[model samples]
Target: MKNKKKIILIVIAVMMGIFLISGMLKGKSTVEGLVGDPKGTFVNVGKAVTTDIQTKISATGTVKAEESEIVFAEANTKVETFLVEVGDPVKKGDVLLTYDVETKEGLQRDLEKLDLQMETARIALSQLQAGSKQSIMQVQTEIASIDKNLLDVEDGIRQLETSLVIAQKDLEQVEKTYDVTKTLFDEGLAAEKELDDAEKAVMKTKDQVSSLETQVASSKKNIETITMQKSNAQYNLDLLQNKVQDETKAQNIAMKQNEIASLVLQKESVLEQLDKVEEKVLAPIDGVVSRVGAKEGSFVAPGAELMTIINPEKLVVEAEISPYYAAQLETGLTVKVKYNGSTTVETEGTISMVSPVAVQKAAQDKGAVSTAIPVKVAIDNSQGLKEGLTVDLKVVTSEVKGVVAVPLLATMTDKEDNNYLFVVEAGNTLSKRMVKQGAADNHLVQVSDIEDGDIVVTNPTEALEAGMSVSYMLLEEVGE
Candidate 1:
């Protein structure tokens, strides 16, 4: 109907325009005929359209990636090189940047110095033990060798003494035989040759005894010398043990070991520092590089942002909803997410989760603070959505079937906090009636008092009091 009226108006305007331009028709007469009489004032009106008022919960939020992270430098250093640039896709542990490591050279020098110190300490300990021969094993070996030699000497002395005793007995027997032979020869019953043989034998026996006695005496002296030598060896061993303990050799060795350990610890500390100095920053998550905060060769402090990575394919919408409807909206419910841009884009999603805790959003106009519960929606196909894109959402927290409802603007509150609206009667007179309000969205609301197709003034002004007659322009109102 509106399009038809526009066509008729355009045709009439063309006719009037042609008539005035040709000067053949009187313009004043045409003007007077078009506007002959004045009309009374008319108030614009809207007919309540009978429609299903879905009890939806609406909110505005941002599009966020499920996997996202802001990379920061692990340590304070100058940026050396960026291995990847913005918009480049990368995996976890991929190198994003490297830091300047001039300090690593200094650390290496310190490590080298510590290495030299450790080496010197070890050599010093070795030198302290060199040629000392003070160990118990060494002393024990010396004593044993000396003792064996002494035993050999003593055995020789005993064998010589036995030989001497045998030699002396044989000499006595020969002497007696010689005396018997001499007596027999005097008696003329023995020859002089026998007596001479007996005498020679006796002399030979005496000579053998003399030689054995000399050997026995020499063996005895040797035994005495060997015993003295063994005793001296044992005394030297005991002296070495006492001297070693007095010198605190064991304590000295332990001290040297501790010194080397200290040097080793210092070396390890330097190496750890060097590792940090030459550290390479890696991507924390597998994602595309969305932002590059620092360029190559730029200096950055500790915890400074380097880049941002986000998995664009995995997307979610996070919205702050009123706590009143937060409980009604839970996970797995269908949702309509509208991304506002040059053109509004709407996509279907499911409620992923709803937070139980409330967060302070902002202060209301009446100095009352408002709290909101965080809610997340998972998009089925997030192909066109990107991270951080602001969007509007319509979450179907509830649904009322076959119910009477009206525009939310039609409702008002009295001092008693009762909800009411201006209901237009047949004569265009307004009447106020209390209404039982149910779930409401930004547009329509569920009400028990107002039935379907009821005419209610959406924009009731202060001048529109109870029982006042109104000249309403039907279908829609043009006034603000």
Candidate 2:
């Protein structure tokens, strides 16, 4: 009976020792956490693993062709010919169409007529510039002839005056003689034959005076007619000279300029007409015609989009990042892009632009902190993309490799704006450690105070405090 009691006491002591060891193991703590039974106050936990962490923001955008342009015809005309068809490749300055001669013939004729008129006007102007010097000479000669004629008229007038004067004097003398003779005859102091002779002499003198008067009148009329003729010639010469100086020359110069302007307009019009006459649709760039809206003989107007061309060679994936995350984005940052349907076909790109403004989809929605900013990702392998394709873009705004970081849940902020972490020390108790924090993308924050194997508490609560006796469990093991 003594031997059995001693054995039982030994077993009891051993059981007590086992319990103590177990309790000691459960309470003992390390930087990571206390090594304990898998259950205490059961709480989910995460590890502060060394990982190459990347800060990213995601947005939705469509693939756009790099070079897209719209072409239009300028003139108001119908399509006359089509030199190429849809999907046909075209170069710069290639003629797209040719117009029917019938339609343009009328314009051509009108232009020709204008050309003739313009040329005639130019010739007339030239003639004016020459100033009818030959004609002027002829006029001067005629003027000289008129001057001579006028001089002759003046001379004749002078001669007629002199003749009139002479005739008047003779008549006076003859009258006196006749009066004396008649007085003698009436006194019968003279012979009857002598009286008869005196009568005849008086009659002859009177007739001679009448004849001289008629001759003078005729000479005066001749002079007056010659003078009138000279004046008419001078008037005609002046009219001709004025025509050469003013009307014909000026008209010709004006007409030449008009013709030049018209020719220029016609050239432009022809080009415009040829452009409108084109019906062939060609690829705007070295691109794939992704869409064809109209076909041959289709009636279209300006600004009407007929087809869509996508230059897969130049593609960009546009993304709309939230304003909150956009502040971290910048140009020339690397990006990872994945098509919505084909996530496996991944491509790399670079950030081309970061908008400074924030955007919101709905009026009532909370505006994104960087909502107004447009984040463009220039895809390197743009040839693999198509227009209107949706892509998922992950822009690596920042990254840290092998830095001491804690899960965001492990951190707590107090009213004093102090950021701290509850780190497991000795005896399953958490010690609050104030840490200088670095960048935090979202759920992870970088800390300089923590080391590679430091134990940080996850899911911190108010009940947790410094130097408090707390039971804990190991949620995750440290990874290399």
Candidate 3:
């Protein structure tokens, strides 16, 4: 029992010693924590730096293809076939799709009508050119013939008048003989039969004279008819001559040529229309079809969506900038583009344009407004860029030399739009100093009224206040 009691006493002492040692260790840790960070906070420090500062206009933007184009149906038609799919690469002049016209019957009817018109014009022109001259030539030949017949009729009339004169003189001589015979027979100086024969001779002469007169009258009538026919022929010849004059090359030939030319032109025009109606839509540029809006057999209205093509290698940023700085932006100014969610991946570009007008972002809220002007930035090297990606924009407007600069982390903002910083005094106590910030690129800004070599706390924590005790640090000492 004595040995067991001694063992219990030893165990109790050892347990008390272990508890005391643990308590002491815990107390030392509490004291160390107080010495290390009295306010349980971390202080980030940076010095007021004197350096060159560049001012930049900041904006947010989205990636756009340099040559993005939206294809639209140019006419009302049904899609015959879609030759490309979404994401398909296409070259310029490649057929994107074709149209199947619903008005095929109407088009065919129109073509037939045009064909008939052309045929009629062609036949009419040919007849005027060939048949008209032939008719005039025939009329000229007939006129010549009529003129020759008229001369013949005049000669026949002269011959008939000579015959009539000779016959009349013979009749007169015969009548004198008959009278002489009658007188002689009555005085019994001649036979009766002789007298009768003389009388018969006189009658024969009278008949001959009458028949010659009838022939002369008939010749006169024939001459008159021939003269009238000759006059009619001459009038017809004149008509033909006038027709020839009027139907010369300047008239008939030119008219025919013009008519044919007009028909040909009309035919060509209608053919072109038909070609357009049945033609395939070709790609106007080399790109990938990012979206296919119409499918095969779909009916579309004029100017409706067909597809969207975008070149992945050619990209630009359409940034919206504050209207205050928009006037300072111009083409050819350098730009820095950063991917919206990326910190390291970035590229340099140039300002392509600045919009002249400001656009409201939202409806006004009792005079408070948000508006911006569009600014375009062109990226020289656009590899790995995608359409519609968000981007951060910075346009370096001007550079300033010998300005007091510091990290943006050191700045604090108040509700009044004023900025300030916490500067450590000689005894390591912090005092607030009002600062005017000029230009900021990213993490650094040009600060006014802060002298070089002044220690400014970069990040002020909740543990800090005016005239508070703090541990000191130089950021360079920590490899930060």
* TM-score for all models, in order of appearance: 0.46, 0.52, 0.46
Q: Compared with the true structure, what per-residue lDDT tens digits does model 2 show for residues 236-293? A: 4664577335664466557666776776676566556554544344445555555544
Model 1: per-residue Cα lDDT over 1-480, one tens digit each = 225434544564565446445432443333332221122112334455545656567788889888889987654468888999988999999988887775466668888889888888987676445524644556578778867877876787778778878888888888999889989999998999999999999989888888878887887787788778777666545544564453565566678889988888877777766666655888888999999999888877657889999999999999888877755878988789888777777798988988878898558577678888988999988877888898888887676667777766666667787878787777667777788888665667777777667877765544557776654334433331
lDDT of 2: 0.65
TM-score of 1: 0.46
RMSD of 2: 27.4
Candidate 3: give the clashing pairs.
none
Name the best candidate (by lDDT): 3
RMSD for all candidates, in order, please.
Answer: 33.2, 27.4, 31.4
Better of 1 and 2 by lDDT: 1
- Native-to-model Cα distance after best TM-score fit, residue 321 in candidate 1, in Å: 5.9
**What is the Cα-based TM-score of model 2?**
0.52
Which regions of candidate 2 deviate over 4 angstroms? 1-43, 79-284, 291-295, 299-309, 342-344, 355-371, 476-480
Please give the CA lDDT of all the candidate structures: 0.73, 0.65, 0.75
- Number of the predicted model whose TM-score against the real structure is largest: 2
